[model samples]
Target chain A: MHNFEFVKPGTVADAVAALKGDEAQALGGGQTLLPTMKQRLAAPETLVALSGVDEMKGICKDDEGRLCIGGGTTHAAVAADGSYPALSAMASHIGDPAVRNRGTIGGSLANNDPAACYPSAVLASGATVTTNTREIAADDYFQGMFSTALEEGEIITEVKFPIPEKANYQKFVQPASRFALVGVFVAKFADGVRVAITGASEEGVFRWTEAEEALSANFSPAALDSLSVSGEGMISDLHGTGAYRAHLIKVMTGRAVSAAA
Target chain B: MELSDSRTIDAPREMVWQALLDKDVLKNAVPGCQEMSGSPEEGFEAVVVQKVGPVKATFKGAVTLEDMNEPESLTISGSGKGGAAGFAKGGAKVRLEDDNGQTVLHYDVEAKVGGKLAQLGSRIIDGFAKKMADQFFTNFQEALEGPAEQEPDAEVADGAETGEKKKGWFRRMVSS
Candidate 1:
């Protein structure tokens, strides 16, 4: 809506350098940033596009048993790659085909919307956010609703997630946009289980420790039956009540567990 | 959407209630609050940025305290607009009760959103509302719990990590 300058950088270093000013924003897929700008919610004087940054795109596995995903990888590539089922499924479900084809992981995490799928994935998988200056733990990376620990001008180079032993993501999508109304990502690691929920509760993206504890003892669907997701602090709106969403957490947790199993 | 949850704090009700009233403490605890300042008397003003799915909006508004019962119970309400992203308004009735030496907080919050947030993004609104509420209470818990943070041991948990939870890893790999 407002007049803004755009700069497509040739590399991650170039993009970071160009993002020095206060009103400068880094554009990845333009899935989130462009919409915000068009809505006039954000009026950055300059957009440092990372599309040309070669180092900021792709997928690879490290010898350390970790997978590193570049920030600029489109959702389409992810969803089409069956090797990464969870990421592909998540990307496939984001908005629609157009959005999936264009949305990038770096842009999504940098934006850090509480209900965004990537935040859930990162948090659930216990990933690391690798940026220009620092590598933030997944827990520290997400600060709060639409907020993150990233300093201004910091560009997320890649995110590292340990390949889970077995994992699955279950989301109850809103019909129109295919975004999670309430989604759950469940992983059973060696020490314990990790359960992450999105689109259901107000705490933003969070690990359901209680449910994880239940699953750690027993990784079956019935393990979550006795776990009561309290509605006391859950969000209530036109689509559903706090209790309703809380109910979905358990139900979806079961489905994700079963799917992963 | 409606979000309600309670957590038991190991402190007295009065102390917990007082903590709720402390603006500086609240500013730090409330999620996505870029800036929050004001008094319980004049009602506090805050700027909150929220993102759900593809929608992102920043809301600026004021919150007022009502139905105060000192260190026992109170009601807090606020309304804000996020321009084209949408507008939202809500209030919470919070109560603190003594549970032995601990205090248990009970809250009931009601909120409404208009514009694109209400129209195009209604499905996840409940989830978003619930998540925001959880962040509010959780932040309160953290503030009460103190910040002697624990370093999450990723190396220890790496082997156990597996499954479709690998999306972030794939994305990272793809980008690299």
Candidate 2:
């Protein structure tokens, strides 16, 4: 990687200010960005490190009773945090030990990798992505693969997940990367149910609305008996075919709902 | 990895063909294309910077148009080297079909990557490749379709958002 300036700000304002330059990029855990920089695929003139910001690194419940996780909180921390057991369990399985210790929920969410785990939980939980500038609903935050509603220079500050009645995340991990080949998250809310699938769609994480509807009426694995995931927009790669992923989506969703129940 | 996609552009087949052959159009449409030179007949040399997951590299390569049937179908094959990141070589068969006044552009691309990139995993590379193909077609369609009807400033905004997709798979092939 070419030489670049590094700045670690103690506050969000300072961090945001440091990223004002056109060539500046935010650094999060370096799990993804560092390797990218090492390969010289990304050559930012300035590296604004967000790790040093204290306000962006913890977990708690806000006025709305939603679990709010600071953007800088590492996956390891989330994995250990007892506030949300299912989310913590999901975080524990992200990547491996080193990755979990270094990678942050914000980074994973920001990168929006199709195979990433946090997106499924965030979407299923009906979370809110709070940025330095504004708040965005989870539904509107993720645009597509590696895409989000974040505007230029905006920094994600925290994610607020509404407590679900019952929730579970089941990931069919790709052996090599530990990233999901097809992961499913099912959350049963008082009003309805939400099922989100990751590592399957060409367009990235998406809701299994049909499954959601099925489970809303009858919250059980048997409720998903007649439902089928279409392979129309599923991703196909060396790991699995679109059809296989579609099939796994059904299997995983059933397992997740069963586990949650 | 192999990628195949088709897009329907709201333009004539001849116009689509001309746009495909135009260097400026290709340069603009290709994600991370820093420079492109030469012609369709002589083959074009290009420099592109691409990123996938965490790896990024600059690739210098050449592309030659083969099996040309003019305004109908043609094959484009090219290879590039990216020092330590790895290298990639591939070709795509592009076919243009006219449906009334519109043109349907179809492409079948087969590409291979070797080196650190290949070591990273096939799933990431495949995802990146598919995204690049999709972006290329989206850009091509937008170019042919002109600016959006309501957003008069959309064209300028769109141009500034170029290269968001990491491209240069062939370049990420070298040892750094």
Candidate 3:
């Protein structure tokens, strides 16, 4: 790994200013960024650690019942917080105990790995990504696999996830890493249902419209019985086939609905 | 392991086939492809950086056209190495059929990975491979659809979903 400067900022302003260089990247939990850097897949000249920024930590309910989560909150903290069950559940399953203790909400959303659990949760919850510059909807936040709408040096301050009337997440984890091989997060709002999928697609996390349509009608596992996930746009690897993943999507969707119900 | 999948695009077969060759379309569709372009010898070349869990690797590779039936069918083969991360090689056979006015592109792909990636990763290779194929085709479909404002009226299989709900109080949690 290349030698790089590490700066722990006491405020968001300092952190933002510290990210001026082209080779500078914000370090949240260091869950994803550090590993990438160590592997030399990414070699940033500097890492602006956000742990010292007290403003970017914690979770609270907003005036509208939406949960406002500081980007720097750890997975262990989120998982232990009973108020945000969905988000907490996601935090608990990120990688392992050590990873959870160090990973942050902002890091996960910014990195946006296709199989990562946080993306699915955020998308399903219809969250808004609040950055120092602007707020981005979850739909627009994820650009593609391992990509996000975040511009260079732009830091994510917080995320706003609408607490659904009923919601649950179910993932068939890759045993070793505990990453979702095919993870599904389903949430039902007063108006309809939102189904987000990670690990199954090539383009990171995406909404499962067919399952949503079915669940929107009844919000039950049986509602999705007739729906068959499209194998056309999925990942086929040594672990499973495209067709098999499509099958798992349905089975998982059903399980999610059952759990939520 | 061998893995394959495809999608029916809402356009003419000719248009869909042309979109397959378009650099911008491919750049938008291929996962982790930072740069993509057509090479000499009826092939495509790209630079990609892949990150799965704690592993990350960069690859520069080319996809050669093995067989071409124009708007009807084509076969593509390629391979890449990501230094310590690993290496991968694969081929895909694509067939285009006209369903009414729309083009249905059916593809079957077989891929293999070796080195640290194959040895350390779990049984989720199929899942990852399927996702990559889907990204390619979906990007292909979006590109062929152009900047059209209206969503295409098409029939497709069910959509995929991922779930990561809250765990019980006693469950172990991984951060970030």
Candidate 4:
């Protein structure tokens, strides 16, 4: 909206350098940031584009048996990749082709919109978020809604997810925006199960620890028969009430667990 | 919507009430207040800059103290316009109770927004309002507990200026 300098850096180092400038913000896929700018909600002096940084744009596996995805990788790319089936499936359902094509995992995580898809996957998988400087666990990285442990000018270079034996994500689609009105990602590992939820909290993406505990004990939908999600601290808007989201969390988690199991 | 919270400050209830009348205390307690000046009775002119996620706005408005019941309870209300961004108005009812040497401060806040901001999701608006209200009260509590500010002799000054016109909330700035 306002006249601003745009720098498309070729590498993460260069992008980091570019962001060190006064009032400069990193540009990911421009899915969230661009619209925010157009809305005049945000006006950064400069935007350091990460799209040109080829170093941060792919998916692969490390020797640790972890699925490592470049933060700059587009949702479309993640959807296309089959290395992590649950993540891929989750990515495929994000918005339409236009958004998936342009939205980056780094942008989504960094923005940490409460309704975003990627957070649930990363959190559920117990993924490691690697920035230019250091690696942070997903639990520590996501502080709250639209908040993160990211420092100013910090660049997320890679995300390492320990591939689960079986996993699935179930999201109740908010028809208008296609964002998860309430989404649950259920991942079952050798040790236990992790259930992370998005689009349902006032506090942003959070793991359902009670459900995690129950589901871990018995990897079945019936294991959750006695448990119910509390409506407290849930996101209540025109799209859905907190009570509605609380109910959907149970339903979605059940669906994910059934599918994953 | 509505939000309520309470905090206990080491300051006396009377001192806490006097601090409420201080624009300096208010400016510091407000999350992003850049400027705050003027009398509580006539209202204070304030400029506050806030950033919620990606949205940033500079809001300029007036804060008024209404329905004051001495050192017991009072309402602080403010409305701000942020150009094309929109406008936000909110009020908080603060009640102070004496607890030996300390004071327990309880506040209930309500907020409303319009224009471009109202279009933003209610979840965000509600969350931000809660955070702001919490921050304001927490800041006030901490400030009250911290090193003391000078005792405001505003009442004597008010009596000097008001003469015999009125004895209530009509506080006139006196040239000491």
Candidate 5:
């Protein structure tokens, strides 16, 4: 790894300021970043550690019933919270215990790995990503694989997820990594159903609109029987093919809806 | 792994074909090409810095156009080494179909990575390759269509000219 200076900031403003230095990178939990650094794939001149930012590390419920998660809040903390069962269950199953203790929702969303678990929940729950400078809707926040609306030096301070009436996330785990090979999060809101899928697309987390429409009219696993997702743009690797993943999306969505029911 | 995808561009087939041979267009279209020089005929050399998720590396590589059939179909193959990070080599078979005046571009891509990158996992490489191929074609199409006004988003950082450093590895690949 390249030699670099590291600084832990106490506040979001301080973290942002520290990241303005030459070739600086924000360190979140270091679950992904540290491993990458060790491989010498990512080398920053300065590392701005966000863990020390005390204000960004908790889970709370707002007056509007939205679950507000601090950016620094770890998977372990979120898993321990019983407020959002589906979200917490998803969090509990992320990687191993070590990763659960260190990986943060903000970091996971920031990295926006196509295979990660939080994005499916965030997108399905229609969460709002609060950055230091602006608030972005979950729909607008995720652009593509590892891409987000957050500008350079932008830090995700909080995520506000509107608790759904019923929600469940079903993940098909990739054996070695424990990352989702294909994960589906089904959320039933008062007005309609919102279905978001991850670990399946090259476009990152995306809404399975057809399923959402079907489930909105009739919320059940059978509602997805007529709907099928094309594997054309889905991610294909040694673990699974695009067609396999496309098939899993429906299977997982069915499983999620049943579990939610 | 083999992946197939297609894109439709607003420009004419001839224009799209011409742009494919243009070094400047490919340079601008290349995601992180910091420096690219050489003709399509003689093969081009480039220095690129890219961040795929968290893996950021300064890749020094070479691109060579192969199986030229003028405006119909061609293959673009490139191989790059990112020091200790690892090395990658890939190829894309691009075919063009002229729809009236518009060009419909179809591509088949395959990529492989080894060393630390491969060690990281198999899950990422295929998706990264597919994205890269699709991106290259998308960028290629956009280059021909319009919007030359804005700079390419991928080309960041202006490093000093890296002159004649590593030729041994590429020499073997190119020859072999």
Candidate 6:
């Protein structure tokens, strides 16, 4: 809540330069950072706003045929984009209308909340996180709960997702917050199948390899019947027990696969 | 809310007990601890800042160790006020056991939050508390294992590394 400088950079280069200050932080939609500042939990001396950067705010298919979403692109834009039906549907449901309109995909992925929806899609879709400095594969990008492989002062420029043969995201939302209490994202490709679960693990979003293997062989909800998710690393809280989340993981995954199939 | 966890440190029980009493180690081990004062016998006072999602608050609190089990067990209870954000009161029963040459530490913690934080939902609060406990144990374990093992070359660059890891957990708990 203390006084701080705010700079809206016109380009990614300027934005990165503005973030070079001692306590400077990147500002996306202010959906997350603003509230934290108001509570006085985070007192950055300067905020380098990325919203004004033109190069970081669009969605398009790259020359390589991968779907590329600029980091500064809002959830609302992603929701409206018809090229990827599953991703658009998932984006439309993120945190009601206000959050969708204000929160940016870059902010969501950079923050990497365990219950956040973006990580599931990014991980399952086998995306690449393009930063100001380098490109990080999704597998290496997400380290753990709210953690990523991004170095200090690194800015995410874009996220590239390879369009899958079939993909779907199913989120079992917690009524109060609307966050995925347990969400599953299933993506099928010519090479194989990938399944990622969010809002369940203590460590954060992770691939359900066993379910992926089963579904790879038989791309149907019934294929998940014999596979069981263990509660070993699942989170337990007032909302649900670890066992319940483990059960929901299977249920959600099954639903996602069924929808995708 | 109540939480129970156990961790084994690669050191003797006596060494672990001494490390727990060391103010410097405790300050570093505690997540977001800005300042700390006092002693194990008379009690300790500290200022800690915690952020879950968009909610952040600085808490000033006091803790006292009760029961006289030497290096075996003790109970720590404390309370802190974070202005409009809320207040939290909690206590933990800690036990240390000898596992061959190493020491096993077990803690049973019970805590309650009132005000804006309580309204945020127990699930988020539980997640934050769990992460804090985990971070503390990790730091404590690292301290007990000695600083000699830390990479000398990267020590200068460790400030950002430590802050990022700590921030990651906080952001994770709240972003959900």
For each candidate in turn, the TM-score is 0.69, 0.87, 0.70, 0.90, 0.88, 0.86
Candidate 4: give the clashing pairs. Answer: none
Worst 10 residues of 5 chain A by lDDT: A143-152
Candidate 1: regions farther than 4 A off? B1-176
Off by over 4 Å in 3: B1-176
Alpha-carbon shift of residue B58 in model 2 (angstroms): 2.7
Ranking by TM-score: 4, 5, 2, 6, 3, 1
Candidate 4 DockQ, CA atoms = 0.46
Minimum summed lDDT over a 10-residue window in model 4 chain B is located at B167-176
> What is the clash tally of candidate 4?
0
How well is each residue in B37-141 modelled by candidate 1, as lDDT tens digits? Answer: 899888899997765533547799887889999988899887898877678888788989899978899999887888877775564566566666766776565
Better of 1 and 3 by TM-score: 3
Candidates by DockQ, descending order: 5, 4, 2, 6, 1, 3
- Report model 5's TM-score to 2 decimal places: 0.88
Query: What tens-digit string does per-residue lDDT give for candidate 2 at B63-126?
Result: 7789989899988777788877778777789999999988888999887888867876466666
Give the whole-model CA lDDT for all candidates, comma-separated. Answer: 0.75, 0.82, 0.76, 0.86, 0.85, 0.82
Name the best candidate (by TM-score). 4
Instruction: For all candidates in order, state the fraction of native interface contacts they contain.
Output: 0.37, 0.34, 0.27, 0.54, 0.80, 0.29
RMSD of each: 10.8, 6.3, 11.3, 8.1, 6.7, 6.2
The residue pairs found clashing in candidate 6 are: B53-B174
On the 0 to 100 scale, the lDDT of residue B151 in model 6 is: 35
Clashes per candidate, residues 3 or more apart or on different chains: 55, 17, 37, 0, 1, 1
Top-scoring candidate (DockQ): 5
How would the candidate models be sorted by lDDT, starting from the highest? 4, 5, 2, 6, 3, 1
